[model samples]
Target: MARRGKKKGRPVSGWLVFDKPVGMGSTEAVSKIKWLFKADKAGHAGTLDPLASGMLPIALGEATKTVPYVMDGAKIYRFTIAWGEARSTDDLEGHVTATSDRRPSEADIRALLPDYTGLIMQVPPQFSAVKIAGERAYDIAREGEIVDIPAREVEIGRLDLLDCPDENSAVFEIECGKGTYVRSLARDMGRDLGCHGHIAVLRRVEVDPFVADDLVTLEALEAAAAEARPQGEPGEDGRIVDTRPDKERFAALDALVVDTGAALDCLPEVAVSDDAAQRIRLGNPVIIRGRDAPVEASEAYATARGRLVAIGAVEAGMFKPKRVFTGR
Candidate 1:
């Protein structure tokens, strides 16, 4: 058997809750974070539209394994809907498709809030990532095609009218489950009140266990990178010739990361002994010894010596290893 070649970059692991500025795509943010950390791998928990700003959690290296948990978690968004003109993409970037002089009163908007709350059927915007016949819905919409997008059930846990800045627009804060589209909510609300509408602004403030305090802006990240970079002159090859200690360089960048296990905080955790952890690491189920250990859980994580070992199903007295994490 031949040995597999090692992957590139440092084994940096953790979640970097990013304040993704408007106009930057989610993929671009992930790429930039990977380059900044010089990590072997990186990924984001959820995709934020290019026009949307706020918490887009980027996971580096081993933290990528926990992204699904964050993605499945509830999201809180603060957005403003401009009432009067309906747009093609359901946001400011789109072309105006329809127009009306009608603007909903505060009473009208408040009355409509109940309709948006709880489980509701939503048809995603035309310019969205939803797939149609193996092609992206946005692609089809771009070709000047009007495709019928079916409505799907989405749960909005809480919806509130935050402010009505003027007669033209109103701000709202919504806490919704996975797959809820704020753009759709805006569009539907406008339609209901007889005023065409589109998203004027959008920002995600929270994703379950993560929140505003967890966020780090791109400007701050660049500043930390500068502080971490060794004082050096460019070599003949144009690469930096370092004049800083290894520890100093690592500490600056590593400080930006929240623990990889932080993303799994919502899940039940079972702290295990080293011997049992080693067995769990090797794809074997281990008997969970403590009386307080959950007897049955569909999804749980096992940690040993403060590091994550495996995420698995706990049945009876056993913790069955499903996906194991190697920090490297």
Candidate 2:
């Protein structure tokens, strides 16, 4: 007995807070989830290296528009640094380039925390996604070229030592602004302490509005799909079953998807009139006159009838649509 092929996915929209596991690239994760939900389009807010794991916010359908906001938000990473060896990539996956026997004392590491905090100039690793000469630095490095990535100012809101498991390794957590690399931090900290080191384990604990609380594993999602799927009619041979997303399955998947506006909830919101919402949807700027209007906010989410209409910039009491959300 043979079953029919599955139908092409429909326009599914929302955000999925996926707890990505190690050894999975962000793109691969996105592809897997997209296939599972049969979504029309998908993307991720940030890139989690194959060596690192944790919250990877996947945007489906209309939710993809808010990816930039999530990417620019602050991120929290808890990682372990293995003392004694420095790697070419500043992580476990790369080749060892140097080694040292000395390990920094807890007090010594704590004493230097203030120096790493706030804004500091940090150099990115050679094997990085950073662009140089219109090409990826990692690609150039792979070609056996000397990649010199200059130091740039990055903000580290907090860097605290969590535990000292042993003389060989220590764990720490950090909350940093965009463009900050944990691998570079591990490498530089080791150099400062006279013990060459590299990142051994790295996991992102938080990204702005997203946290561990919202994380759902891929296995769990599969289970949800199976549980939601209605029993299919058995073929004459009883060896085949139809597999297609009915309304019930779509409802089940929708339960897991966060609203498209959830990513932009951090920003102030403005409510517009029915007439104004239509004008804004047409890319026209409208004057929002009300006490609830944002006074100094350069950007905000505009809603009408309790539904997110668009993201817009406000200036002199006028709200101009920047990015509009078209589909549900």
Best-fitting candidate, scored by TM-score: 1
Error of 2 at 168 (Å): 0.7
Taking all chains together, each candidate's TM-score versus the true structure is 0.95, 0.91
Clashing residue pairs in candidate 2 are none
Per-residue lDDT of model 1, residues 20-132, tens digit only: 99999999999998888878899999899999999999999989889899999999999999999999999999999999998899999999899999999999999999998
* Candidates' C-alpha lDDT: 0.91, 0.88
Clash statistics: count for each candidate: 0, 0
Each prediction's RMSD to truth = 2.4, 3.8
Cα displacement (Å) at residue 219, model 2: 1.7
Q: Per-residue lDDT tens digits of candidate 2, residues 1-328? A: 7998877666888889998999999999999899888788999998899999998999999888899999998999999999999999999999999988788889988998899999999999999999988889899989988798889999999999999999899999999998999999999999998999899999999888887888888888887777655466778888545475455556766788887887997888989998899999899998887888886578898998777889988988888899887746
Q: Give the best candidate by lDDT.
A: 1
